[model samples]
Target: MDVSARWDNACRASLFGSFSLSGPDGAHIPISSNKARALLAMLCVAPQEAMERDHVSKLLWPGRFQAQARASLRQCLLILDRALEPQNITMLEPSHTMLAIEPSIVRSDFEELIEALNDLRIQEACSLLATIGNKPLLDQMDFGDQFRAWLKIQRKHVEGQLQIAVSRALVALDRDGDMDGHAQLSEAWLACGRADARHWDGKIRIAVLPFEQRDAVGGPFFLAEGVVEELVSRLSGVSALAVVARASVASVANSGRTIPALASALNVSHLVEGSVDRFPDSIRITLRLLDGPTGVQIWSHRYDGTLEGAMKSRPHIGANIIAGLCKAIGVEAHTRAARTMTASREAYSLYLQGRALTYRAIGDGVLDKAIELLEQALELDPDFAECWTALAEAHVNTIVFTPQLDRVERSQRMADCAARAIELDSRQGHAHSMRGIHEWTLGNPLGALDHAYEAYRLEPNNADVTARLGSFLLYIGHTQAALPYVEEAIEQDPVYGRNFAMLCAAHFNLENYDAALAAGQRMIDLGMPGMWLAVIEAALGDNEKAVETYFRQRLLMNSVILPPAGLAPMDDDARDAYWTIASRGICSGMEDDRAIYCQILDGLHLAMPDPCDASIALPAIWMGHAELVMKLYRKQIHPANMLGLMSLWTDVDPIRQTRLHPSFLSFADDIGLVAAWEKYGWPDLFPRSSHID
Candidate 1:
């Protein structure tokens, strides 16, 4: 009766599809008691193969007295021991206080499945998952409420893992050109329906590659790209699907990568690719929907029409493409009808030209020209919601990128255009996004968040909207919640540099300096301002690099003068003094609010700006002047400057210190942050349970 003597090394427990333990010879070991099987499962899934005896008892035998629960657990262990003895398996190692599974003696299929997926053993993972075949964990067994709660979480976790694994396997199969295998596996996966569809979770992610212009020797090449953008916008409305951003897809469209490589790069489940061939007065468009994982063509279609006819029929074509894709993917295509932006073909063409101009408005007078074009488009069709959104966007670019322009006038125009776009079509995500930006500029952080969330709900797949939501959340100190949105936006549009900046901020606030540094480096690589990198580098105890980075940023900002010499060997206090003065110089050559900011940084006690800018509080916060921060907080800063508070949560040296101050909670409470935290979860630096202490 020595269980250790009969221990079988090949014993394996199958927790998915069915609950069974098999011996080395592939024979099922009888485990008659469901509770015993549940007990085995509890141990297998538990971290480090161990769980406290009391906790395990409560989970398995909830509602029983503590002593009775303990007794039941003991009885369950004995049943498992007896069942495994026949297979020569010493399945568990139980002490008076803890129960531990003996991995050397027996292993679970779930563990093997996870290992296979992690190691990219796609074939093996697919095979193991196919056995589960969408079946619920433990099949027909039901446990107590406490146990059920634990099971529910585990089930969700497993479902997520399996979905990713299966998706990857399909992609791998497609890459290898195994069509039959892909077909079989696809069927198996479809049979196992997914349970999570919230936001972008457990959704079909697709990227539309820029359409090829076959006769581009002199034809309208931009039209090809326009087709892709139109399709991307149309597909983004589907709740069951997430579309990759046009910028990312376009960036890689001409790289000549294989289908599988394209899918991998975009992190998508499907790809839409096509070519546009020009005729004398018409065009021939051929579109193909490929399974993202397998590169197998699920559907293909060709449309031939006159140039004018083709431009006007884009909505109908997009609908057909969406329908075909959804049908092949086994998902419902619940899409809103595309609104006609303009009745005039000329206006629609002008709108496309103007919208494209806004994307690359860094050149001299580019934004001005885009604004002119969009305005003309509106002249012909003033009710065009999309054109209004595009006009609003152009105005915002002028406000932020063109410092020479009239900021107040541009801001007003941006707000009015956004309001009009929303009035025309409340469902326009970009319109809402522009309005969100306008709200933040007006110092209404809460209103900004409301508009941002509405934009996200309207177009969850849009990289810009997703990134904006993350940015708005970060502004209000919701760093943890903001992290995933930033991450998802980066995945959808990796080439867009702003999301990486947001990513850096999120990681920095969470005190993840290494990740923050990496993200900042990426932002820099993408040609964005790397001012945040200096802060992250400083946080990681690299003051020399931090100083170098800050100086470089100031130089880029065209600072009139540099930090004083002989600063390298300066003590911490002196170095901080130099840093504060140098940081203030970042706003050099600015006017209005920015000029006020510089004055505040210089420590000249002038009348405070209408909005108590949180950014202006940075020098004091970094100097550990908690009282100053509190004073500013009490000033009831303009609601328009509320978004600027994001600067206060950068997790720099004194930020954490400031939050830890005795009066910090009172300040937070007065600013309505405590209530926000209570509703949306506390920030990383100010956990609800620990901040009070």
Candidate 2:
């Protein structure tokens, strides 16, 4: 074949991640040695695809004698050429004075990226950039200092050019009034920026308002909710856009505020609003993309389709909305790959409705209804991974909030649902996260760790994944390692109550009592349950605040009994049982009552093995049930336990004298707790003398 034809049908080299050449059929052509691979990469990234022999030798062998360097270079080239020869393509052209790749014989993705940018083929350039995808150039290879320096400069130059091309493309699309094209480009541009270490905080933030329902007669009112949910889920996957949470949008959705006012309230730069009209055979959706600050409609579209057709077209409609918004702001928006699928529209809609209901139906009949809806969804489409994952999550919530249920059976059901989700789609991060929680509840810490790590890897920016991983680490007694992940989760999702709760637990474990108390208070302020706050207050010796917090929680539970329609479900029996136990402990100083209360609460909350004994021990200590606390401590320190370490805190000082017990001392010795105390001193919140006391 001629050179150009050969280039088209010959092996191509990938310089990103690991250096490797792939033949025409996409099989790897292994180079003989690291030096040979390095030499090839050096040539490919070199200016004009050519380098003088003397310069190449000096760069690859900076410390060697000139003759020795040149000899090494020649040997490396021979190895590389031999490796390329089997592919029937000329990769390198060598001469007495210089070496170069034949102009039309080989093509590099890096080179094509530059060519695409030069031609203003931004979309093609962006696609190629995704292939490189933040990987360091010739990532695994270690070369001489001179060549490394050249590689660094070249990588930076490539990144800069990619960023400029993306910026130019976005501007051009906006100027041409091609909103859909601009939206499609935004994701790729953001990916490039992220890979190049550019900040994306300057990108426009958009919120999708809950679509209003008009003239609906006995159809699913939740169809609007399902559509809005799908749009939000899809848009949130776009790294270039910051999507406001559905809860935030729903809070002011019907306030009759102007677009500018609503946008300011939600802290968003743009808004997407739509109205859904349902008829006998079809659903019509009219959507408008609005400028948040100016209340201007940038783009509007009307879509008419059957329910099934609308379900299938939601992604395309969402993309169009994003495109219009991005174009309005002189940027690009790229639709992310869809991660959810369902063969039945009814199943898909039911899943969305189930998720919505589940979020609102904690601990009550509504949760059961949500579960029923999800079960119906599964019956309609057994392969619906999202429904399975959602069902697993709903079961987990039941395990946490509905103590009246058969805890063991519920836990097993959760595990089964999560496993089914994984079987259907192992790549779904939600499945892995749910499975991790299931494993954690089963007291399989190592299995939990594996699933949690995989979930985090698949969805690094997902706040829920971050929280789960951090919580898993904390539960396993890796308090220090878990702190940053929890903190980052909080940063990413400041409004999330669970993140703050995890932070509180982490800080308390670290013996940063003041910080822990502050986090606990923040959780309470956010209208989340704060049973832990009372414990923290009691531990800090604020008995009055602890007593007040106890009553406040009771009052909160009372109010929840009459919760607004469709909100969190109320389990009166479970609430009453909890109250009866907790009230006895608080109402009197009787040690037996306190101990009973602690044990019952442990049975309720410690549905799984608690390696650190925090579930039983912390509450016992808070209630001043010193004897029961010591018993729980002994159980935690047993030799058969998987975790050799015990989490100690300053709050346990009232039982300091118990350290002299044979079991306590032996446990300390077995876990090196005493040695840790002697070497590193007591944790920041504890008194040094308390360890020996």
Candidate 3:
């Protein structure tokens, strides 16, 4: 440990102070020289993963001689070691390639500064007196161009880190169920951005229409208002649905249009309209789904439950109505949806009221209320597949951040309930979705993919189905493959919350930074709070005035990373294929990540034998190392340790690729790719661009 410290510490004499080896207790060591200190700081802050020598070379001496720079660095290291001895630290060691910091117990001012700065950002009250009192590094001496660049980089990074911390803190206040804190933080971020901050902020949209009357007699507006309020609470489950408040919607309740026209007047895709007919025996309510664009009836249904327990039951019924509407638009019903609907209806109504209190708590606890409702619903009808599904969904909902439940428990319960649902109705895409989640949790990638695909197969037009599949694809790191599905999901049901985010995230896997930005903006426009929104916004250089709402995330009690982590590389079939498509799409415009699209298929030179989606695939019998590009061609995967996984792509069977990409000429004479292209339908497909490669 002693020797490691000596080798690792980049201690040197500071121009502002005499040699020392002491912390506040005077054991801190100093850097050997200004240059050495800068070099050390530069290396320490470099992205932690592997880095090439060329990067350092480019940063230090863009137009200078390498030998001179190396000599300067070596001299600084020697002096720095001597300066570090008092603090029992070493700054560097001889390695196979280049100098590296040795494992050591050396204290570093840079590290301390970073920690201090980050802490300060979180709490403005954090004392900077110690930092202010500290002696400056080489304060009087000129550090030169290389050192200057390093300093600039450090300052940029430090400020960025601080901003993120502050923003995150403000956002947290909003998330831990604090509306006032949330509003304050959101306003703060927004104000800062609007004033001088580089980042842009998020926007909000809302729609409110007349409540379906339970009794045309117009008893207490509370019941009618409450029912509408309850429906908004249910729909808000979409997460992205900014269901306008009853007060706001009341202004337009008398639009006099049908559901479709009413929705149009409200400027929303969904319009909820109904009339409560009273009879001697029970209450009859008629509801309708209207296409806001054309003012046409998309779908309509009627319910005949009595008013004996209508207040509490209305919200759940409303949830069922919304879910039914989403399903009609082709959204897959998953376990999550079931949980939201089946939780305690009365409690859920309270929860809806709770949402109105965005003035008060977050909507998260709605799950607990939902669980209660579902439990009660089950008590009333144990064999009800809907009830079972909702219970499973409630359990799964808890899995997102529960300390008690493991992922396996969530996956298993969801699967079991879904299986039960399917036992009752195999055509239920939502049930299969649960089963797929189980397969994914169990490390069966193919099974997961198959289940997601099956859900789609069962309901080709379902938005939720496509959204769920896209989510599954993205989670597996096959982001490129998720794009089409996500887009279709959003298209099928534009109101499906988070669908746009999913679509935007798909671009991250392909490293399509620009497209990712556009996607983030779309979400902000629709109202979503996520890392991707900030990231893509950053990637696109749009630090205008959006994304301040993300500050609402910073106000909670938790310690969260801001801007979050960057996306990892695409290491699977799904990922590679998506990227291949994205890259080709960038220079070209391949719409599909499927193998049938020769653009992406052209990058693959491999195959899969037991292909889940593709009929013809490569065999293990004649396996070969897959090239990066080729791997992208196949949408397949191999799970890692039941948690991590390599993404999948389309199959790479020789026979399949022949049909998918076609490496041979039709006449069997020409061996060139152009001849193969000629045989394939590239000219017919992408008529705007011919194959240049």
Index of the highest-TM-score prediction: 1
Query: What does candidate 1's lDDT look like per residue over 396-418, in tens digits?
Result: 77655543324445666887998
lDDT of 2 by residue, 523-542 (tens): 77567767667666665666
Models sorted by TM-score, best on top: 1, 2, 3
Most accurate candidate by lDDT: 1
Q: What is the lDDT of residue 566 in candidate 3?
A: 25
Model 2: how far residue 486 lies from native, Å: 3.0
In model 1, the number of clashes is 9
Per-candidate total of colliding backbone pairs: 9, 7, 89
Alpha carbon lDDT of each predicted model: 0.68, 0.64, 0.44
Error in Å for residue 470 of model 1: 2.1
lDDT of 3 by residue, 612-646 (tens): 21111121100111332233223332121111111
Backbone clash total for model 3 is: 89
- Clash pairs of candidate 1? 6-88, 7-88, 8-88, 171-293, 174-294, 442-640, 443-639, 443-640, 443-641
TM-score against native, each model: 0.61, 0.56, 0.38
Models sorted by lDDT, best on top = 1, 2, 3
Off by over 4 Å in 3: 1-272, 277-281, 287-364, 401-407, 537-693
